[model samples]
Target: KMSFGTGHHATTFQMLRHQGQLDHQGKRVLDVGSGTGILAIMAHLLGASKVEAFDIDDWCVENGNENFDLNGLTTRMGLGTIRDVQPQGEFDIVLANINKNILLDEMALYADLVKKDGFLLLSGFYTQDIEDLTDHAKPLGLTLIAQQSKDNWAALILQKKA
Candidate 1:
């Protein structure tokens, strides 16, 4: 069974809210660990020109595609990590709502995919984990610009330094 996002979790909600705050019009976006494709769909509705999403789980990839189809949106949903999926070029905005360990482990790759001065939004970690995340991000030229927390869950929006 695939564990998909229902937009009910604090992290997902915060991610959604953060995404809403940003202007996605005509932007190229990437949704890492896309789960049920909620974020990808939201990006489309927000006017992103291109959206690429992937997950390590085959079920998630399939389910996410189904969700996209149901929403009548065309999305590039694949099965694998960012390295395995190998999406080409940098994105105007990158969304990663995965856990702390995976976020840290793939931070460099994520940073590389963000266009200079573009945004990377992250969640799925505890509020206490923010410092460690930002710490790792800073050296990669990603600076924290916005943050939101619900209960113990947290989300951050970082910009790739131009």
Candidate 2:
């Protein structure tokens, strides 16, 4: 596959497992750096009213759209960073399974896109890097609500403070 996130990597697996536990019914979700659209598809399957995704890689964007098609979902998939995505108002949940550097750089943008009291799920970093991620998120008013780890990889669920 040209894209990433086939639910095989530890980070992707934890992201999927943690995402399944959330209540997605009737919610608007955003998936950042969506590779193969796995997380975006999961949101739809979980009952999210709308699912949108974006990736920096062109191949990933194409693969994501194909995956959405296969899943019978009409998700809006874009090719670029979060900044390039068209505004669709605040989301009920924002999932970013990107690396630590990108997450840290875009933390504020992600926070701004989530509705107050909504969720922000993140992964794609080592368990030891959780502190750096959390520390950066805290000031953005995103409180760490839950976390999962496997094989030194970690995923975090945070809530935007109202």
| Candidate with the greatest lDDT versus the true structure | 1
Q: What pairs collide in candidate 2?
A: none
Question: What TM-score should be assigned to candidate 1?
Answer: 0.96
Model 2: lDDT of residue 150: 96
- Compose the digit string of candidate 1's lDDT tens values, residues 1-162: 346688988999999999999999999999999999999999999999999999998788888888899887877599888889888999999999999999999999999999999999999999999999999999999999999999999999999995
RMSD of 1: 1.3
The TM-scores, one per candidate, come to: 0.96, 0.96
Tens digits of per-residue lDDT for model 2, 92-137: 9999999999999999999999999999999999999999999999
* RMSD of each predicted structure: 1.3, 1.0
lDDT of each: 0.93, 0.92
Candidate 2 global TM-score: 0.96
